[model samples]
Target chain A: MLDFTGIEKERLRARWVSSAEAPEFVEEVNAFIDTLKELGPSPLKAAVEAKKEEQKEAPA
Target chain B: MIETIKQHVAGLLTEKKIAGFLGLIEKNGHVAPHLFKDGESLAGFTLGDRKTAGDARYPLNKTLVTLSRAYPEETFGVLVRGCDERGLYGLFRLNQLTEDRVIPVGFSCPAELSEACECRKPYPDSLVAGEKTESSQLKKVAEMDGKDLARRFDFWTAQFVKCVKCYGCRDVCPMCFCKECSLECEDLVAKGDLPVEVPVFHLTRAMHMADRCVDCGLCDEACPSDIPLRLLYKKTAQIMDTDYGFTSGLNKNERSPLSQMGPAK
Candidate 1:
């Protein structure tokens, strides 16, 4: 669905980690974070920031 | 066609086959859903035709859900297009209405109506009247699929921005029988906000509808935002069909794959 909405397929990741394997979970998280860093912030960030700015600028 | 339906419904009503026939009525040049308690009231019955036949549609199944709840003992006959029969199958699965308590009086859509709706199935399994037409391909959805991701994003963003948060789509949907709606949840969606979390709001709805959507197109017509919601749901339905090997709202025995508590295949 994210792919359908133009978000890069790399933006979201899923992995099954056992609760007993803390080290494996850490490794998976680190790997996903590295991938995200390479992808940079989502394009939706700028649009959301702009919306917040517009809301702030509006008279209370 | 209307005459045949009236006679059939009349026979059902008189024979105690149905407690009432739930169908659209034309009164004072206006069309609305009404329950005919007996054959004599057939004078006001219509095929929901106005300027065009098979227009002036209503979510009669939603009404049926309420009616069934009030009088669980009674059986009812209702007007059914292909989409509506699909909804009945869905409703039965959801436990909103039982198959035994409802009888369908099926009719096929006019060619123009079928074309306009881009209906996949324009007629039910059987029709009491009107010739069956071929199913329509989702032309708009196909067009959207051919676009690059960037163009798709921009198109959807602009469409979602027009939302006034009226919730007309949910209200008008027969499948939307949930007492508590996730859309209205304050945590998921911030209240008192215009253009509410554009992607999240609609995506949530699309995800929820993936398993349940009957491809009725009522949501598209009800949208005050004029969002092509049916197209979105249709796209999701395609994914559900191709990936999970399930076409939604088809059989009473089949449960939505998502509804089953198990690991994805």
Candidate 2:
């Protein structure tokens, strides 16, 4: 669904980690953080920024 | 075509198979849903044809759900198009209505109606009325799917921005039977706030109905903003079908793969 809306599928992640497996949870979170860094800021925020600039540039 | 349905329902009612048959009636040229009980006149029966093929259609299944709950002991027959049949089957699986208590009397969509809906299967497995018409060849979902990611983002953003937050999509949806909706939550969607491209309302709805959408297209029709809601939900349904091999419709026995018990045969 994220992919369908133009968001990278990698921006979302879901994994079941038992509470006993603290290391696994941390690893998953770190991996997602790395992925997010690579993807840059959210495209939704970019759309907001663009819309603001768009108003100043030319009216639709 | 409607004559066949009337005869079938009349026969069923005569045989005491159903307490009543719910269908549309044209009273004074206005189409509305009506329940035909035993010994009632069938003169006003209509298939929601007004100015166009199936232009005045209603979600009879929603009413059927309410009726079944109120009169659980009585079995009822319902007029179902391709989409209504799908909604009935979906409701059956959802446990909102039982299969044995409700009998489906189905009709196929005309070419123009089917094309307008862009339906995959515009007819039920068995028909009481109209003949099976070939599904519309339009591939809006596929066309949308083929676009580059950035283009999709912009396309969807523009569409979502136009939302007046009416929630007409959810209101008109036949497959939506949730007692409590996540969309109304204050944290999830800021109530009475400006419609944002964050698209929490639409996105949540899309994800919620991902496995359950019967492809009825009511959401698309109900949207005042004219958002391609069915197109969006169809994408989610497609992904579910691709990943889990689960598609909701006439096949009542098929279970959602997302469920903890796994797919039921």
Model number with the top lDDT: 1
For model 2 chain B, give the 10-residue run with minimal summed lDDT: B256-265
* Candidate 2 C-alpha lDDT tens digits along B1-265: 8877888989999999999999999998789999999999898999988888878888898999999999999999999888898888888888999999989998999988888788878998758877898977548888988999999989888778777788788877888778888877778788787654365668888888987898888888788878899899888878877777777884767777766484443
Interface RMSD of each: 2.5, 1.6
Q: Model 1 chain B — which ten-residue stretch has the worst lDDT?
A: B154-163
Every model: Cα RMSD to truth: 3.0, 2.8
Q: Using DockQ as the measure, which candidate wins?
A: 2
Estimate, for each residue in B146-235, the C-alpha lDDT of model 1 and write its tens digit.
Answer: 999888877777667667799999999998989999999998998989777868898899999998899888899899768888878988
TM-score of chain B of each: 0.96, 0.94
Q: Report chain A TM-scores, every model.
A: 0.73, 0.75
**DockQ of all models, two decimals each:** 0.40, 0.59
Model 1 ranges off by over 4 Å: A48-60, B261-265
Query: Which pairs of residues collide in candidate 2?
Result: none
The 0-to-1 C-alpha lDDT of every candidate, in the order given, reads 0.85, 0.84
List, residue by residue over A1-60, the lDDT tens digit for candidate 2: 878888888988999999999999999999999999998888697685666566447644
